[model samples]
Target: MKITIAEYLLKRLKEVNVEHMFGVPGDYNLGFLDYV
Candidate 1:
């Protein structure tokens, strides 16, 4: 089976048990942080 990048990343995060992701508000990281 093939998985998209987003799906793959979310699965990896779940596998690692990453409940919370922290980051400050900034231009570059804002989108990534928001997605988390």
Candidate 2:
């Protein structure tokens, strides 16, 4: 099985009880920002 970097980061954030991820929605990170 393989997990993507986005998946890993989301999991870690959840583990730390992170509730919000704030950032600008731009072309470069718009995709990744969706996971936030």
TM-score of each: 0.50, 0.76
lDDT of 2 by residue, 1-36 (tens): 998788899999999999987887788987787676
Best by TM-score: 2
lDDT (10s digit) by residue, model 1, range 1-36: 996665677789999999986657888765555446
Candidate 1: clashing pairs of residues: none
Compared with the true structure, all predictions reach lDDT values of 0.71, 0.84
Q: Where does model 1 exceed 4 Å of error? A: 22-36
Q: How many residue pairs clash in each candidate?
A: 0, 0
